[model samples]
Target: MTRKSTGIPGLDSMLQNGFAFPSAILVAGEPGTGKTTLAVQSLFHGAREGEKGLYITAISEPQWLVQKFLSSFSFYDQQLVEKGMVNFIDLGPSIAKNPSDMLEIIKKKIEQYQPERIAIDPITPMTDLLQWRGETREFMHELFAFLKAFNSLVIITAEMSYDDIAHSQESYMVDGVIVLSYPEEEKVRRKFLEVLKMRGTKHTTGRQLIDITDEGLAVQAGLR
Candidate 1:
């Protein structure tokens, strides 16, 4: 299977070169876990490689705020954004007023941009739109089906902890699950990256130390 490089050398190595093409990857972690940074970096990298990229924000933050924060990262380029290589759009208001149309909104944007790499940063909010027990699963089924047919590398970020991952219905709906956590060791808290599950690919099994520098996320050598 063809793979899409994550643009992070260490992570690409961990994923056996990169994520499987046209796969839906769930990036679950708590707030401040660098989920957004990783997703944005991936998009920007793809943009640099001449791939059309789209970033859909489900969270209630304005686009400028997101760009402001992302400006700190060296990998983020204003030119790519201006050239329409990487587009950032919000799904917050649409999902807020017409939750039932969330899928349509996403579909419309994807159809319009025809992006090769797409990231839905923090997909957690969409869960609240589900009114019943099985609605989330059903919704995810439709979402995943759409993504598979689109034939694009997809990254869906969620606000979740290690504990929540076990019971998250969303986890079972994706092709892979990457959990990021901040674990304390020797009285110091450090960020760690772990591939909880990846289908059709052999990957590093345990948590690896990660550093979030100005350039972006890099998997460190050996756990400190």
Candidate 2:
């Protein structure tokens, strides 16, 4: 299996080098947990490697606004976007009334650009839009199957409120799962990253401290 670096330092080492190519990973976290930063950094990392990258966002935030926010990070490279190596697609309004439309849009984009890495920032809105467990499950099944066929490394971010991480179905469907969290420790709120699962790869089993800086998200060796 080919390994694709996650672009976050110290994290690749935890996955024994990096994530396997054609793998689907779930990055679940609560608000302010750096989920968006992690996804953008991963996409930028692939762009820097000369591999095409696609970012599909479900929120109403304009593409330019999202780019502007991420530009503060050192990993955010405008050159890659200008060169068409990194492409951003806003699917907020289109999928607001019909979540299944995401599948078609995703398929078309994947077929068109054939990106090596793809990130769906915060898939929670899609799930909420569907509002049916069966529909959400079916959509995920189809989406994951389609992604597997494309031989692309994909990251799907999902918003998790307090105590919701253990019950998220998205965690069960993906090949790998990484959870970013902020838990109270010694009267202080501390950030951490935990690898719940990584199919076909040996990875660290415990939580590690995560740091979000202007450069992006980085994992420390010790858990907070």
Candidate 3:
């Protein structure tokens, strides 16, 4: 199977070189666990390798603010964004008003940008579109189908803990699941990345130590 490098060597090691192509990966984690950082870093990596990347944000946060913070990471390139190698789009307002139109809007963006790598910053908001679990499942089914129609590796970020994700439908639909977490081991706070599942790949099974540095997020050689 063809794989796409995440650009983080240690992470790539854990992932068996990289994520499988044309697959959706659910990135579950709480706030400030480097969810966005990992997604953006991968996108920028693909951009350097001639793969177009599209970043779609579904939050109310200002795009400028998002870019401002992401710019601090060394892998983030203003030049790549300026040249259209990396594209950014905000679906926050539309999703806020009508959560149902998300599928169509995403399809339109993909058609317009034609990116080879796509990242849906946070997909948890769609859970509120309907009251019944059945309806949510149908929506997720359609979304996954639509996502697979194109030849792109998709990253879907969610603000949820591992336990929360274990009970969520989105976790089961995606081709891969990566969880980032912060737990108090002894007396200090540390970050971790775990590859919970990856279809057809023998990935590392345990929570691996990770660090956020000036360049970007990197998986350490230790496991927690």
Over 1-224, each residue of candidate 3 has an lDDT whose tens digit, in order, gives 99989777587777778988989999999999999999999899999999999999878689999999999999999999999999989988887777767778878999999999998887776665543434677778888888888899999999998779888889889999999999987898999899999999988888888989988998875452
Task: Please give the clash total of every predicted structure, in order.
Answer: 0, 0, 0
In terms of lDDT, model 2 sits at 0.87
What TM-scores do the predictions have? 0.95, 0.94, 0.95
Clashing pairs in 3: none
Top lDDT prediction, candidate number: 1
Cα lDDT tens digits, model 2, 1-224, are: 88989999889989989999989999998888999999989999999888899998889888788889999899988889989899998888888766768788878978998899999998998878776645887788888889988889999999986468667778778999999889998999989888989999999877798888887899975442
lDDT of 1 by residue, 122-180 (tens): 88888766654446667788888899999898999999999999798888888999999
lDDT of 2 at 61: 87
lDDT per model, in order? 0.89, 0.87, 0.88
For each candidate, C-alpha RMSD in Å? 1.6, 1.8, 1.7
Better of 1 and 3 by TM-score: 1
* Candidate 3 global CA lDDT score: 0.88
